[model samples]
Target: MSGIKRTMIILPATLVYFLVMLDSSIISTAIPQITDEFNSLLDVGWYGSAYQLASSAFVPLAGKIYIFFPIKWSFIVFFTVFELGSALCGAAQSSPMLIVGRAIAGLGASGLMNGILTILAAILPPHKLPRVMGLNVALGQVGLACGPLIGGALTEYATWRWCFYINLPVGALVGALLLSLRIPEINTKPPAYEVLHTAMSSMDLFGLVLLWPSAIMFFLALQWGGNQYAWNSAMVIGLFVGAAITSGLFLTWEYHYGDNALLPFSMLRNRVIYSASATMFFFMGVMLTAYYYLPIYFQAVKGDSPLMSGVHILPSIISQVLVTMSTGTLIQRVGYYLPNVLTGTALASIAYGLYSTFSPSTSVGKWIGYQIIGGAGSGATSPGSYIAIQNSVPRAAIPTAMAILILCQNLGSAIFLTVAQSIFSNSLQNHLRTQAPGVDVQAVIQGGARMLRPLVPAQELPSVLQAYSRAIDAVMYLGAGLGVAAFGCAWGLGFKDIRKKGEEGK
Candidate 1:
């Protein structure tokens, strides 16, 4: 392919990735409005989790789809599925319908993101991969941060349904661009009919089938462990046990299937693929805490409007965008990824540690500086892992490798979000009970994170605000811990010069 063609493929791949990530966390800002419209908070958790659950469960199968099918048509199909889900979400009259839409979107999202990197791996030369991937990661990270900001703006200025509606035009443009181009397939497989005929054997359909439910079970165990059921309760324990047994079975099946397994044992044994994925797992956990909680800090603790709360997050997002682009360039030049991963995690750890000290009266300069540091951390960390995987794996297996990385990242997000939610709720309730004994803890919890002044008695409102601030502060610790964990995982990512080309895997 020529430069123009590569540019065309790269641009839309990044755009669709941004769209996919935006949908993942953007719901946070719109949830308040959505609940009000639906007149129920009972289904609130599923709005986000359903998308996450479906995405995580089917990601490996997504990789399998890319491997078995032609890249161009497969990508278009995924984009169409995602757009249909967005339409359903935008038109939803009830909460269940919205949850179903999110799940559908998630199913499509699984393919969309994996396809982005896999396509890039197919088209880009090894040396050029890092910088282009850096741009993609930067934009994608910007999309992640901007999700809340954009969601806040749309929800405050228009109906929250517009959050989902926005995906339509953007996705359409992306689909059109993709449809216009003929994407290169890295390998020439047998004809499409023969490929489909033998898909059950080559696709490892049973392994794929077992993996989705396995992921769902693991996520459910986390989601309901301490909240819906006691950790020791039979329901929670049974879920955990089932997840473990099924996971073991999945592994056994993969080992038996060897090179053709959904998660090939040959790749699993690689230091770079497994270690980079480990870093991504914890790295995403840290990144997501910001997407999920910072809005609450601005709205509930500082009494900022949703729109203003979005604005307050700009420092971090902007910083991340710049650093992401820079980091990619630097990694490409230096040919080493470990340093960026280490440095990024360290800065993020310190930034979140500083964030944990935030209070209502905290100086503006303090928060701004902390967010800049956090953004730098995120931008630097984002591209290196994918680059490492690209460098370590052959062109043909990039899809499978990228799929594994995404699975770990999303699984980490799911687990950490559950942990953060548990911590935030418990801490909020506990602090309210202790400091504002007369206030209604349940009512404040249900009120959502906005306009707290009118909800509480004047004498007790300060205490309520303080409680909210501390609860958000508490979740910052989880971010800090995840950053530290990522740093530790970096040690396992050997110092390899990606400038040295990788296997052909032929």
Candidate 2:
């Protein structure tokens, strides 16, 4: 392909990838406004978790769809679904409706993310793939960095509804550009009814059926265990039991299905694939925890406005973006990812430990320095696992391996966010009672961090702030531990040099 033609094909796809990632955390800065508008502060966790759950659940299915259908058409379909979901979110009138919209958008996002990589794999040679993948990951990190800023600007200057509405025009334009592009069809299998049916059957819908509800149940149990109900309550216990049973059934079905399974045993058995997936799981958990909660700390504890909170997070965002782009290039040049992974996780752990020490009186310089440390670590390590897995797998296995990696990343965000939410709420409630005896805990929660100052009595404000600070500290501690665990997981990513592999195409 000519340079201009390649740009046209790659640019739109990268923008679409940016849109999906931007949506993942754009809501972080808007959470306060959303809670106040909907009067459902307790559902804050669900807003993010719903998107993650849907995205993670549909990843394998998306891989199968791409393998069996025309790449360009499959991508267009996914983009359309995403556009519809974005429209729904912009028009939602209630918290539940917004959550539903997020889930729908996530379903489409799963396909777009995997489809973009698959398309690139088809169009680019093995030697050129790393640079393109690196560029793609850098764009993704840029989206991650810019999300809060855009959300904050929209939420403060306009309405939070624009956060979703902004996607409509951009996505529509990108979709049009994608349709006009002449992408080569990677899958040329016969489209007869019988063949289509066979392809669908090979997707293992039963495994998806078993996996989806199990994951939902597990997240529900975690979301509600300490916040909505007692840990030992029948409601929580029943959800846990259901999740366990369904998870076991799903595993058994996948094992029996072997190569036909949504997540094939062959892919799972590869040391590099499994280890990289695990490393990504924990690394993402740590990254999202920081992204979501650091804003809360700034706004709630330090008393910054939404826009100011976004401004404060710039240290981390700038460092993360720069490191992520540079690291991607570095990996391509050096052709080894293990060192970057190790250094990133180590810095992340140290950064999280430092952040855990944040208090109301912590200086600006200290927080900014800590953010730089954490951001650089996260950025360097973010693309390492993906590169490792992509290098290790054959071209034919790229789709499945990519899906597995995406699943781990999304699942980690979902699971760890739930854990952090549970801890934050429980600790906040306990501290509120102990620190300010007469304050109403439910009112405090409903008001969120932004309104806490005005909601509580002036005399009790100090105690409430202290309680919030301590609760956030606990969350940071959890993040620190996750970072340490990610480091250990990276160690298991045994050395495999990609520079030595001969060029091969699917």
Candidate 3:
């Protein structure tokens, strides 16, 4: 393909990715509004977790689907499903309805993201792939960074629903352009139901069944324990036990199914693939915890409006974008990724540690500087794992490898967010009891974070703010620990020079 043609194909696909990522991050700023509307502050984690759970569950299956189906049609179908889900979210009347909509959107997003990367892998030369992939990733980060700003503006000026509504037109345009473009297909099998059915049977649907419930049970256990039930209560314990048993069964099934498994054991054994996935799993957990909670700190604690909260997050976003763009070129020039990964995680650990020290009286300069350090670290390391996996795996395994990587990242987000929420809620409740015993815990929680100032008496506001600050700090401390673990995983990525392999076509 000519340069211009490649650009045309890549641009629309990147836009679609941007839309997917935007939907994921946009809800951060709108969480306060959504919780207030539904009167369910405890459901905050579910807003993001539901999406990540469904997306993580279906990602591997979507990779298998792309391997068997026409890539173009698969992408269009996924994009359409994503649009439908967004429409449902925009029209939702309750928190449960919105969670359901997010789940649906996540299902489609899993396919869309995986399909886009698979298409790129098929079309691009190995030597030039890093730069293009970098561009795609950078654009997605742009969407992620802008999500809070967009969501805040819409929520303040119009309604939180516009956060979902905005996806409609952008998605429509991207879908139309994709339809006009000819996306080359690597799957030469005939496009027939019989073929699809055979492929589907080989996809290990039973394993998917086992995996979904395991994840849902695990997240529910985390979300409900301490808040809705005692940690030792039968309900929470049962859920934990169920998750463990189901997960074990799922692994056994995957082992038996081997190549036909949802996540094939053969691929998992690859050092580069698994280590890189592990690195992303921990790194993303840290990155997403900060992304979701930083807005709350700005709006709920610092008294910024939603729009201003977005503005406050800009330092991190700008640093991330700049680092992401530069990291790609750096990787292309250096040919190795482990050093970048190590360096980035080291900085991330320090950043999160600094963030944990933020108090109600933290200065603007201090917060901005902290965010810049964290963002640069996160953006610099984010693409290393994906590039490493692609370089290590064969073309036929690219879809599966990418799917596994994405699955790990989303799972990290889902699991860690739930853990963070649990920590935040429990710590807040404990601090509130000690700091201001007369305040109603349930009432304060239901009133939502941003509404705390008006709901609490003036005398109690200080205590409430202090409790919130401590809760947020607890989460940040957890992020710092995860960053340390990510750094450890980075060392296991096996020191391969991706550019050298690309040049040799090995």
| Best by the lDDT measure | 3
Deviating ranges (above 4 Å) for candidate 1: 35-45, 502-506
Q: For model 2, how does the per-residue alpha-carbon lDDT over 243-357 read when each residue is reduced to its tens digit?
A: 9999999999999999879999889998888889899888888988888888889888888877888889999999999998898778778878899999999999999999999
Residues 102-124, model 3: lDDT tens digits: 99999899898898889898788
Better of 1 and 2 by lDDT: 2
User: What is the model-wide C-alpha lDDT for candidate 2?
Assistant: 0.86
Worst 10 residues of 3 by lDDT: 187-196
lDDT of 1 at 208: 78
Of candidate 2, the 10-residue stretch with the lowest lDDT total is 497-506
TM-score of each model, paired residue for residue: 0.94, 0.97, 0.98
- Candidate 2, position 259, lDDT: 87
Cα displacement (angstroms), candidate 1, residue 496, comes to: 2.0
Tens digit of lDDT per residue, candidate 1, span 392-411? 77788889999998888877
Q: Quote the lDDT for 416 in model 1.
A: 75
